[model samples]
Target: MARKIGLYGILAYVVYGLFFYWYLFYFADSSLQFEYEGSKADPATFLNGRELMLTEEYSKIRNLLFFLSTPFEWLFYLFILLLGFGNAFKKWAENSSKFKFVRTAIYLFWLSLFAFIATTPLNYISYSLSKSYNISTQSFSSWMKDELIDFWINFGMMIIIVAVLYWLINKSRKRWWLYAWLLSVPFTLFMMFLQPVVIDPLYNDFYPLKNKELETKILNLADKAGIPAEHVFEVNMAEKTNALNAYVNGIGSNSRIVLWDTTLNRLSDDQILFIMAHEMAHYVEKHIYFGIAGYLLLSLVGLYLTAKLMEYVIGKWGNALRIPAVNDIRSLPLFLMILSMLLFISSPLSNFVSRYQESRADHYAIEMTQNTEAAIGTFQELTRAGLSQVNPPLLVKIFRYGHPTMLERISMLEDYEINNKAKTNE
Candidate 1:
């Protein structure tokens, strides 16, 4: 009877997870629905037939590359298994046992190095493809240097995190997940605070936006939107990529609006204002803090699930994997595997929240700009420049897209235009 109850509990948990995924995918925000039927013209009317075909082809290539990369990603999980089962990490850990935490840190460094080496080929292939498609202009050597820099930075941070996590785990066996989550709060915030200022400069050049006329217009828009930003930045993205983009980055005093040179080059002044307004909307709506909160909550849930799942898996395969305890350094692979699985399962929920936030920002942009034509034109230019799909498959939207489909965004603008015209007539 006890065994049957345990099995039932597992079944119930599985059902609950499935239900959560379904809810997030389909019913998370009924408010996002559009009232007006879409325009008679197709969304792809913005693109010529050749551009449309190229857009589709680019999307297909990306999807195929993603599909191919899945096996490589799964191979990473298998590699982790080998690290744990083959006692490679354990042996490394034992090699420096005379020092207190040195052995564990060394083991972590080795683990991080192995992961970087294993993943570099896929990263290289992605870069190669981007270059082939004329999306990236960064040279191979520059890309390699950037990747190595990224590796060292991430590896250093991971060592510190793993050390702190193990200290917490050793301190409390049952409540380690809670402690780890608490510890992550400050680390997450610090990273966000640091990335824009300290980290971004390692790769690209940013200058105070040089187009004085456009800069004046953007600051005026920022003031109108109550953003208080003084200067807009233009990143030298032309040297790196052909894709157009812009964003708001950092927090508090460090916060600034950054436009890719590609965006400034491709989009007109009015359209640029619309895009800046969109990014500014993120600040006014407090999306950054809300995003952090959402991620923290998700991480908490993922961690809790990982703890529960870890106990079960370890019970079954602890000896086979040479993983003695949750707190042990040798168990890092299993810990990572469980965390990855939980995050993967919960991704739709995360993306749903992001899409809603982005949709809100879109509405805010249109309202602030009050220029429906420029708003529509901006997305049209983005679709053409980036070769983005106007309407992706439903699963892609749910699982991968952090914003609404391009067609949906365009249709919402079309509805806004129709409704405003109706209001004017009334």
Candidate 2:
């Protein structure tokens, strides 16, 4: 078992290295090495009513708060380490032996509640900071309602997953990881399909964009990109957030290009078109399907590593932790801890792939729109409005940033402009 674990670890490491090299060297824009001319002398000159100082301060503080919150988030694992989760799970298991499914559901409820309570303070603090910074517009009560809804949704999902996972573990202790990984693929896809329709509407109202003219413009861009323009939808997000954002989500019948009302209100038609083009590029380039494939691949590797690590930990410390076997519900915390740690360590690789995909979308956006000015302005406005860090530290970028730094994105646009001009001259 140890030999197999070591062999799997080595193979995973080598695969990750190759993937890293490919994404960094081939997939990503190597031209990210351009000179940034720095922020415009007058932020208002680029966009009306923009203040650089205030925006920069907001960006810095928002980023700092997020960075500091990481360790606080990790405290849940610490609670688990101290046998808090194990004891709760054991107690729940003892009390609800009448029905296996009901017992699992109760265990899940307790576990989810434990995590929610453990993390709520930090979550509230983050929310408060966002509100203070004018990023959040939702009132406290509304926000709490959303949080509770989210908790229950997650709890509902976890109960079924826990039941399935433990069943697999009991049936085939040695091959449970393989079965679990396979199960995750369909479950993830189903959730993705449901999220845009069933889940998202729980929090906010989505409508066919109210701006008919802008909708026409975006649909035209979508048509140019050879994607279904009818899939474009707008979320009534201004009631909850002042942040400007848009994204393409889901796959097949569930797929949609969603723009925030805040985004439509704040950005110009050209800028909105640029953003729509970026989102369209995700589908036009088949990134939605490709992303799911990448996720499944990583899950396969992660689950295998998790199973190996969980076995070793149980063998060594089961007596002390009171964890009898992998199938035992009380051992969930330890299993989760190992999986979380592995995923954390592997995040750089994941982030690299994500950054590469985003860069491709950026490239497609530029090509599809042929409006470098709008692309540049969109980033500048988003940086100011979203309080996004234009330049983050190297380690932070590798581990945390799913997209390139705002500065890196701006630099890529500049590179695109220069190349486009040279091509025109030729």
Candidate 3:
């Protein structure tokens, strides 16, 4: 019964992909319109309040990928397949007359290496495409350099993480998933510590926010929020990619607000402060801890059930294909691709977790700063720079959006301000 259900799970993935592709092409709009001063009755119509538009159509399409949804869906799907199949294939290779564990290991190593290389080109392509349109400062070479840096850094990290995960699973015969997640807390902590100060610097230059007055205001806001210190920083994210993003990353000394230079260049000081305050809400509320905790719990369940069936699936089908080792380097792409598919299917749940936290932070930021106009302007600037989809489909937003759209956020702010005025008038 478990095997049958597992097979169905895999099959459901394919069917879902076909459905989403159809939906994306047929129904998803290329442009989004937002009202800054008013709202449309339709939930599908996102309102801000201004008469101005926040995004161009192409940007809408692009943002529909990346931050909202992956543009390279196939690539993501194939990655998962390789990871799932490789380990199970190992046991089969063990039993095979011609296959050996060394061969399997070699296969996996190459598969991972090649898979990383192939997907890497798209990293450059995204930047190049933007530059060609005269929207980006990045040259192909510059983007490639950043891509190579990220590739090496993430590739090395992957090997270590994979080794740790496999070890926990391999050593513990039963309930390995539980053990793996239990240990992942420290691993997550290490990542939080290292990401801003270490991993990020390789790809983008991190510097102190240049505007002293703005920085001081942010620091005061942080102090008001009960954070110990303030180290406002800016990064040259536009030098690599044009995506406008801001995040509250790190813990303690490593803690800081990382704003993309594009974000700084586009938003006003007040708007920037609002954005910073919103990011602080995440740290103040400890959203990252909750996020990691949730992921670990999910990973425990997903990896355990999936890993168990992997052996049977590979033995029955993978070996029959005459592929001696499913874990071969060539197969690495496929494995990762498959895992991404499962994750994609699981996206709605993941996105819900992210959206809830982001929304909470948005509300917190509004409360902390009490600057609805700044918040509205910040949302508008981000929408214009990032080319956000104003009102995405319910399912898509629930599944894809890591943060609420400019239209959604600004509308919430607009309503609050309007209500506050009405109360005062009363």
Candidate 4:
């Protein structure tokens, strides 16, 4: 039964991969063009011949990479379990330590290391693709350094989570999921709070916005929007990627406006202001808090479902999988597999919520700046710089896009311009 389940999972992934490949390379290219009536927002108008080619090629590969990543991860975990590496790691940890925490750290270190090594090929492929397309600026060594940082950070977090999760399971086997979800709320908030100050600076240098004149203008805009922002920050993203971005990060005191140095160097002052306004709108509308609430809600349900699924799987095939029980350390791979599957399934709904929030932010930026041309230009520049598809396929938009497409954004700006001009004429 376990072998059949694994076979079924592999079959499902292969079928999906084939469909995704067809959609991206063939059908999407031929049929997914976006048209904007009387506006120069179409891909052909903004992206040059070379850029159009790059965008098509880059978008296809990137999407394919994304499609493969999760399943690749699941396969790694599955292989580890099937090969009895998970049981071996658990036994090694048990022999190494009498302490539960120490044993967990030991077992999870091996697990994390294996997962990291397994995933490196995909990660390197992504990096190489970006480098080939003139997107990534980081050297291989520097990129590896960032990857190492990410690995360690993830491993550390996994240690904490696995430790607590197992403890809850041991304490209250049936209600462990409930307790885990309850505990996760605080942990999530704590991580969010620390992310800006503690974690971010580890990768890139961050300093107050150097352009004092523009800084003052941004502050004035924030003041007008009632955001109470004291300073705008500039991160040294030019060392990493050529992509342009501005964002609102953190909640409350940690909250601040952050602009990628690439954005500052590449865009005009008005364009930067439009980007800042868009970011500020996220704060003004309290999107971050709402996002947190939504995440916790989903996680609660997901954890509950995961618990039920874990029970069913282990009860049925515990011996075959070498997982004695749900709480057993050997079951970590199965736990992760179930969670990953749930996450993949839930991605479309999450992306829909994200797109709605992003659309609201776009509308707010337009209304606040009242500079439709600047907003439109900003979107165009972003597409060109990132080689983004102006209009992606329906599946791509549903599963991958967390923000409106470049075409949608530019067309909305054009409509706003028309509406405002009509009101003035009246």
Candidate 5:
């Protein structure tokens, strides 16, 4: 009976995850659905559905997510570290392995601590994990610089957010969530504006575009598309590593064509032209607007759920804190844990949406470039530069990868080209 109950509990978790999303995807009216064409008549139109949804949804998600996510995310991190330690110990004991449980525990303890203090994870994770590969550009000092900057910024931001939210919730207990939500909107907007503007700069150097010839070529493309040429710029990506990349970020004044230094260094002039054309495709599609909209929709729903759920959860932790306020710092761990669970449950769905968008972008990139050979070459170089696993396990890739593996993308591109050629020959 006990074993049966355990199995049912496991089954229930899986069912809850699936049912929650089925309700969202099936019942939800996110007509924000999109289709990508190789050569769109108006590139900006690709993101029409998404753009329509952005402002409406953005308001709901940003506030709700920040509040819900703030309390639970950190706790999830602790859970993972503990689980990893426990697993490592179990393995060590089974074989009496070279590294005993005690030693293993010590190693994980120190590495996680150093990783925490040095902040060399996330964006530079490739550097830490790619030690065996030829592609990583992270040195200890460089890693430390990334780690420290990230730690202070996040740590300081959390301290302020928690303090302020606690203060507000104390004063407005009956309907404090509404005011908190409103206050959070400006904070979210500030993050959207300042994150890429201020926070991004602290990590990677940004500069105005140079190389008049290359700039001119990009400018002409923008002009042809009716996108202002002055909006495009270059950032110094070469200082850290030789990995080529580019993307379009923001809308209006924030919107700009950002080219990584490595991209300029690696690709031929024509290749760069093709790459920029692909990026222009995204700008033309208005993807950012819709993307933000999707985020808002997800948040509003999540926030409603969180406020009710958090009150119940926080009430328990509140009794323990002797502080009736919902923003007790001691309960931070519990909230973070809940958020982590929420994210874990949502991970598969998030990846599904991301994968769909990425596929559309890839299709647009190829169509705008109209250069299959160049596209292939660019992807190949990127795969090598980033040391991408071309054939990652399907389950692994599905959960973790936002973009299709290089092999899958290359295969699709090749098929498209072959089909087009057959028609041409006919």
Candidate 6:
């Protein structure tokens, strides 16, 4: 039965992949083409013929990869469990170590290593696609170096989390999920605090913004926005990708605005200021805190659901899965599978909340900067640089987009401009 189930899982993933590939490459281009009826924002007005074609092709491939990778991950975990690899690793760890912590480290090292190997093909596909499209500026060796760094950092973090989780489970089987959720709140915050200072620098160089004149202008805007930012930092992302991005990261003392070198090089001073204004809006409106609160609430519910599902699945299929109990270390893959499925199912809800916050930030940016042309120009340049779909399909918007589409943003800015002009005439 276990072998049959595993075979079915593989077949399902293969079938889905073929269908998704066909839909994206063969059928989706014509079907997903969005036409603008609004007077303000039109694709043709911004993107040239070649640009339009490139964006469509690039967006399709990216969407295809994004949708397929999650299911592929699910299949990978199912394969590991059904093949008895999970139990085999657990046994190996036991024989290798007398201490529980050491045993856990050994078990997780193997699991993380295999998971990394399984996912590398998809990761490489993404990298190769980016290179072909002129998006990535990274060499193969540099990319692999970053990939190794990510693997080790993630493995270390996983060890810490899994150790705490299993310890909680042993202490109180019935209430471990609740306790885990409680502990995760602080741990999540600590990671966020550390991310800006510690983890980020490992991947790219970060220092204060070089253009001191532009920095002062940004600081003036920050002062007006009531953000207590003392300095702006710039990251050297040109070495990796041609993408332009900026964000406000961390909490409290770590909180500051960061820009990509690509952004400073590619955009005008006014446009960069508008981008800065948008990022500052995230801080001023407390979106970071709100996001954290929303995450904690959802995780509380998700953990509760995951605990119930894990108990039921292990109770029924313990022998088939080779997981003796919910609390067994070998059951980690099952736990992760259930949690991944839940997270995938809930993506639309989380994405909706994110879009709302992003739209609010757009409104704040326009109100603060009062430069509709700069805002519109910035959005156009961003789309061109990233080759982003200005108007994606409805399903993609719901499942993938966290911000308003390029069309929506440009239209909003145009509307804002018209309203302000009418008020001035009055």
Backbone collisions counted per model: 0, 0, 33, 0, 16, 0
Ranked by TM-score, the better of candidates 1 and 3 is 1
TM-score of 2: 0.86
TM-score of every model versus the real structure: 0.87, 0.86, 0.77, 0.97, 0.67, 0.97
- 276-329 in candidate 5: lDDT tens per residue? 877776667776666666666555555455556667854653443232334433
Model 2 lDDT per residue over 144-250, tens place: 99999999998888888889999999999999999999889889989999999999999988888788888888888877778875846889999899889999887
Ranking by lDDT: 6, 4, 1, 2, 3, 5
Candidate with the larger lDDT of 1 and 6: 6
Candidate 5 weakest lDDT stretch, 10 residues: 36-45
Among all windows of ten consecutive residues in candidate 2, which has the lowest summed lDDT?
A: 29-38
What does candidate 3 score on TM? 0.77
Regions of candidate 3 where Cα sits further than 4 Å from its true position: 1-22, 29-56, 63-109, 121-125, 133-135, 165-173, 241-243, 321-338
Q: Candidate 2 overall Cα lDDT vs. reference?
A: 0.77
Clashing pairs in 2: none
TM-score of 5: 0.67
Model 1 lDDT per residue over 86-199, tens place: 367657677768675787777887777787888888788888877876778899888998998898888889888888888988998888899899989999888888888889
Off by over 4 Å in 4: 1-6, 29-38
Model 1 has an lDDT value of 0.78
